[model samples]
Structures are given as C-alpha cells and as structure tokens.
Target: MAQIAVFFLFLAVIQASVALKCKVCDDTDGSCSKLRDETCPAGASDREAACLIHIYKDATTKKEMTEKKCVNRFKNTGKYDCIENPNNQQIKCYTCVEDFCNEKNSATKLGLFGIVSLVLSILVSKIL
Candidate 1:
C-alpha cells in the first residue's frame, strides 16, 4: 500500500511537471512566415501562408516531433516576407522542443488541488 501511494505521488508530480510545460503552438497570421524574409515588402511574392511545419525524426519515427517555419509568398511583388517560424529552421529563431511546455493546465490544476487539500486537512484535524 505504501508503494502504491508513493507511485501515485510520483506520477502526480510528473503529470504536474508536464502540465507546467505545455504550450499551444500558435503559427497563425503570418507569424511563422516571418522567418523566411522578415523584411520582404508587400507585392514581392505569391506563396500561400504556411503557419506550421512539422519536423519528422529519422523520416520514420513517430515518437519525435518538431516545428518548422511556414512561408507565404507575396503576390505580384515576386518577393517573400518572412515572419515567425515555429520549426526552428531559421538560425535566428530556432526553437527546441525542450523550450516549450506540454501540460501547463494539468500542472496548475494539480497545484490548486494540492493546496486546497492541505488546507482542508489541517482545518479538519484542528476541529477534531
């Protein structure tokens, strides 16, 4: 029983840690495209806006994933305007998976629950 309790505690800690690191990928509104040109003037290119690019590991490994930059070409200008790149392709804005979080919500919930439980236990024991 003690072992089970310890295991649960460990699992909870891990879950909380994961939650604290969770971050939603936001690659919209030309954010990821900025990585390509950063200063391309309007009408310089004609590429569709790419918000998020997936990085595959070893061409076959599904366990590992990363983000890349999505570029949008400007129409009539024949130029490219670079924006934010989530894929870490650009040397200036490369991001590793370790830099992001995956389970922030869970971690917050766990923390709140832990605090509330501790307070309640203390209050009940005092009343008893």
Candidate 2:
C-alpha cells in the first residue's frame, strides 16, 4: 500500500510540472494575431520554459524581419547566436515566461534591469 501511494505521489508531481504553452509564429512584428499556440514539448529543460522572438533587419533597405519561436531562458549571461555583417544587419532576441508573451512586441516593456535602475534612482533621490 505504501509503495502504491508513493507511486501516485510521483505521478502527481509530474502532472503538476506539465509543460508550458506559448504563441508560435514568425511575423514581421512578432504578433500572434494570426498565429496559433503550441505546447512546449515534454522533457524540455527549465531554460526552454519561455517564448522567444528574434527580429532581424536588412542593412541596406532597412526592411524589418522577425521570427518567433520557443527558446530557452537566458541565464547569467546572454545565450543567443547571430550573423555578423560589415553592413548593418541587426538582430535582436527577446524572451518572456508568460503565456502568449511572444504574441506582442516586448520592446515596449520595461526589463528587469530597467526596473531595478528605476527603483535605485528613486531611493537615491529620496536619500539626497
């Protein structure tokens, strides 16, 4: 009886840790207006717990291109790869953990560093 209870407990833990669902698309602006949601595959690591968006730009024409997909979360240091060009092809990647987070452009959102900086500035001003 004890062994059966333990087995059921383990199953509960696995069920509780089910994978995430995120918007999957590759639009010019990273919006999911016309895209669908996908569940992150099982066995995905913690790093892959977030949705990612990659934006690219054409150096000469200034045309913007974007790609949205599931990606691992960034750790202590940046974790992305891009092509290099002497011209001006710019590439930027963003990651968010919330459901359908990649549906909209996150450039308008304040990042962790920005929030921390704002708090520190307010505190310093109060002190001074």
Candidate 3:
C-alpha cells in the first residue's frame, strides 16, 4: 500500500517537471490560426518555458500584427493580463505557464485539481 502511495507521489512530481507546449505562429504569415503544435525545448528552465503573445499596431502602416511563441519570462514574475509595452504603447504582451496558455490568456486551471486528485489517490491507496 505504501509503495502504491509512493508511486502516485512520484507521478505528481513528474507532472510538474514536464515542459509546456505554447502556440507558435505569426499573423503576418497567417500561421497563428493553424492547429499545428509548436513546443519549447524539453527540460527548459522555468523562465524559458512560458508562452508569450505579442500583439501591436504598426506605426507607419497603421496595421495590427500578432505573434505567438514560447519565450523566456522575466525572473520573479507573476501572472499578468495583456499589457501595453512601456517602450512602445502599441505593443501589447501576455505571458502564461501552461500548454498553449498564451492563447487562453489565463493561469492553467489544472494545478489545484491535480494536487487534490494526487492527495486523494494516495489516501485511497493507503486505505486499501
């Protein structure tokens, strides 16, 4: 029973270490709307695993552009909504830490649920 509990605990920890898959596309080429999956390098650092979506308007052309890719995030960062660039207000950016999370533009809702499920499974295994 304890071995089963240990196996469940190992799986939960392993889940946290996997790299996230972020959408990688550009509106300039119209690939942003495609279904192909682009992923960051496996086992990348936390800073390099987040998804980034950058959208902005062109200054001279007055056109809007969009880009999506996995990008390294600033250290010690928290979640943020799409925000205007400080240097160029026309550029808006959003970053998140789950697979294709940039498109969703929100925190991954699975973390808490996964933790709860892991705990419950461990308890059930011990009881058995």
Candidate 4:
C-alpha cells in the first residue's frame, strides 16, 4: 500500500511540472485576421474565428513547438465573422510564437532534484 501511494504521489508531482498557454503569434501583429490573410493564407479558410492551437515543449530539451492546431489568431480587430471555404470553415495551423517550458525555474529544479533523491534513497533502502 505504501509503495502504491508513493508511486501515485510521484506521478502527481511529475504531472505538476507540465504547463500550457496560448503562445502569442509573432505575425499579423498577434491578430488572427492578418494571419489568415497574410502568414498562412493558404491554410486560412475564414478570415474571422478564434483559431485554437496546441503547443508544447520538447521533452528532452524544453523547446517549444506546435504539436497540433497550429493556427493563427487575428489582432483585436473585433471581427468575429466566419469566411467561406471549399472544405470547411475551420482554421488550423496558423502563425504563433514559440512557447517555452518554465520547468527549469530554480524552485522547480530544486523540487525535482529533491524528489529524485527521495526516490533513489527509497530504492536503495529496499535493495539493501
């Protein structure tokens, strides 16, 4: 029972290391409209709509990249209308800024190392 509890606790701690947020698009002045017509014109079907994007950092190096829905968002143009497209009116894979993982913060690093040491000590004890 204690081992199971410790394993779950470790998982929870690791899960807390992950963070997410909308990476501000560099093109179109952070506007979905301009991005639709400029940066990724080919990918943009409608000139208006909230373009949702999924982003994350590389597991090994913590580099930011678009994993899915890499669409662009228009500026604060207040134009929330949908344009026409041959296939569908959904916007995906637009322009976006790179998102970086902040897990390397001093506090986070300390906590991570502490947890790792604790786990290692527990394993060593069990082995001995």
Best by lDDT: 3
| Candidate 1 structure quality by residue, lDDT tens digits, 1-128 | 44544554555455433412213334543222223322212222344332223433323332333344333444344244435334434322222112121222111223454444455555555555
**How much is 14 displaced in model 4, in angstroms?**
1.7
Model 2 gets an lDDT of 0.57
Position 12, candidate 2: lDDT: 45
lDDT of 2 by residue, 9-79 (tens): 45544443556566677344433346778876533243446666766675777866666666665444435
Pairs in clash, predicted candidate 3? none
Sort the predicted structures by TM-score, highest score first. 3, 2, 1, 4
What do the candidate models score in CA lDDT, each in turn? Answer: 0.34, 0.57, 0.64, 0.36
**Comparison by TM-score, 1 against 4, better one:** 1
Model 3: per-residue Cα lDDT over 1-128, one tens digit each = 67777777777777666777777774455235753467776432444567777777755555666767776664467443555544444555777766666664354545554486599667968698
Highest-scoring model, TM-score: 3
List candidate 2 stretches off by more than 4 Å: 1-17, 26-33, 42-46, 74-88, 107-128
TM-score of each: 0.23, 0.49, 0.62, 0.21
Alpha-carbon runs more than 4 Å astray in model 1: 1-21, 28-110
Ranking 1 against 2 by TM-score, winner = 2
**TM-score (C-alpha, index-matched) for candidate 4:** 0.21
Is 1 or 3 the stronger prediction by TM-score? 3
